[model samples]
Target: MNIRQYLDSTYLKRAIQAGITEKENIKIVQGFVREAIDEQFKLVMVRPEMVAMAKKMITDAKSQVDIGTVIDFPEGRSTVEIKLDEAFKAIQDGADDLDFVCNYEAFRNGQVDLVKEEILKCTLLGLKHHKVVKWIIEVAALNNQQIIQLSALIKNVVMTNFKEENYATVFVKSSTGFYKTENNLPNGATVPAIIMMLENASPLPIKAAGGVRTYEEAVEMIQLGVKRIGTSGAKAIADGAVSNSDY
Candidate 1:
């Protein structure tokens, strides 16, 4: 089997959720990223505050690492203006990609148009700076109807802003690691319902995040049409799990 192809086939957004609390941890995470770069991995997503630090760490690295920052984060409670400002700040801090969480509460309250408008605003904000935008439509929080509506809204956004080349991704995520309890969402992006959304999305990329911890899970997500895999366990996946390796 072609291991390099598997590692290089999809976009892997290495998450730095735990390293944001201190400068030392940030340095350690940067060292980890250097190793990923040595392996030819190309993307890294960090918290809003760590963009500058991450940029400094990889500025002279050999790999083409694109920095990403999250807006409205896991809760999705911010106003459109606040989210836009966050995106702008991340860009100024040297982020190459913006991952904005959708307003789940607003969508659940039946505010479909309002949700689309907020996403449109974010898309515009990212495009103005020539940055890639990935809309994290948290599928775990949405019902079937909301998913269908969101899918259409994303398609519309991409079609209307042809020059911008705005990209949208459906993320099947668990609780943002804040809670201590176990999560129900499966590892990787291969959940049946998520696959259904990908099949319906057509053309747009699917980014599988939240619980991906092993190579088997990663491979499963790729087979299910996921174009990107978001994880903090990239090294473990690349090394291969003892029980799950097919090689």
Candidate 2:
């Protein structure tokens, strides 16, 4: 299998998040972009602020790797208008895929209409711009039933409003790889969570993210019908090495 094709090489840490200076952080992002270009991965998933830089790097190298950026990031608590604004800017900055962290908190709080509206509106914006849209449900934040429900919610919104041909353009992604949990529970994609997503969000593809650190785990996700795997350890996975990064 061409593992590189399924990996979205990722680096989404901020300067403070990584405990580095701004200049040093950019240098790290530069190396990340260079590695993705050289490895010919499916995409480089970075923070929204890094989209323009990553776009330029790929353009200069003539690499086919696409640029993706997160919207509403680790916290899905932002209002829909705020999420849309963030996504619009990312799109204009040359992001090929927009992964929005769905407001799972609201859903958990029984604000179903709010969550549904954001999913529909944000997804429409992405489709209008011809970019792949993914809704990260943040599995670690919810129970199994919540995971299934949220995945189905995203699938329902897309299928109800978008054309069949565009179904593939929307994905139900697992996590942000940044959610903190009590007792150090797995805060990323786990097999059980992925199975629930796949079972509930059919036709619309799934992208397994968070906690997927090795090639075998990645392969398992693909075998279970995920369309993509987002990871900071794309190179390690491709090289058949186990990634020790907490992300």
Candidate 3:
């Protein structure tokens, strides 16, 4: 396949969720969004505190952009109420989508009910605002069984939403860039696993994230059935800094 054509065909979504721990990072994120617009790419801005600023940037962009925010980010350790509140506030702030980090510990501890409840909360909130909600499962932290279980859980959630006539999309995502192994390897999600999850997913879309930093890798992901991408290196990848062989 023609690399550029493949990249363009698949939705190239950029993420700007640099946490609110620093001021300079915020400026850099804003600059990234502006530059992404100049390059004509779809963007998903993900800082909880920077949602407002990100929305403003998207609104002011010369080209169209898809604005999104992250809830229960990197940790996914927040209370359900807190996550719901964050989801509502983000939608109210004009975010087009909500990328929610699933409660990894809950899933790890066999708290499937709690995990489902948290995802349901976000689904309801997104429905109220007519926005899309992508659930980040932090796949790198999960074993194959956990990944399969999460897929089943998400399938059930999608069915429930369908019964309620709620039209929110459930997205299985990889990493938040928090955990890493002793090998200095980043603990983010992978494309192959995401595709496997999607093969078992009922109706939700698969969004490949984390270490996707090159045009070729992006194309390979799309061929694997990923509909959206979440990466901070979108500009670099699109500009051909990273190679597909890196994957």
lDDT of each: 0.62, 0.93, 0.68
lDDT (Cα, tens digit) per residue for candidate 3, span 60-124: 66457667777877678999999988888887787777888899888999898899888787777
User: 63-161 in candidate 1: lDDT tens per residue?
Assistant: 576676677776777899999888889999998877788786787887877887887788777777888777766665666677666766675766666
- Order by TM-score, highest first: 2, 3, 1
**Model 2: per-residue Cα lDDT over 170-234, one tens digit each:** 99999999999999999999999999999999999999998999889889999999999999989
Q: What is the TM-score of each candidate against the true structure?
A: 0.79, 0.99, 0.85
Clashing pairs for model 3 are none
- lDDT (Cα) of model 2: 0.93
Error of 2 at 83 (Å): 0.6
Q: Please list the residue runs of candidate 1 whose C-alpha ends up more than 4 Å from where it truly belongs after superposition.
A: 1-21, 163-190, 242-247
Candidate 2 matches the true fold with a TM-score of: 0.99
Winner on lDDT between 1 and 3 is 3
TM-score of 3: 0.85
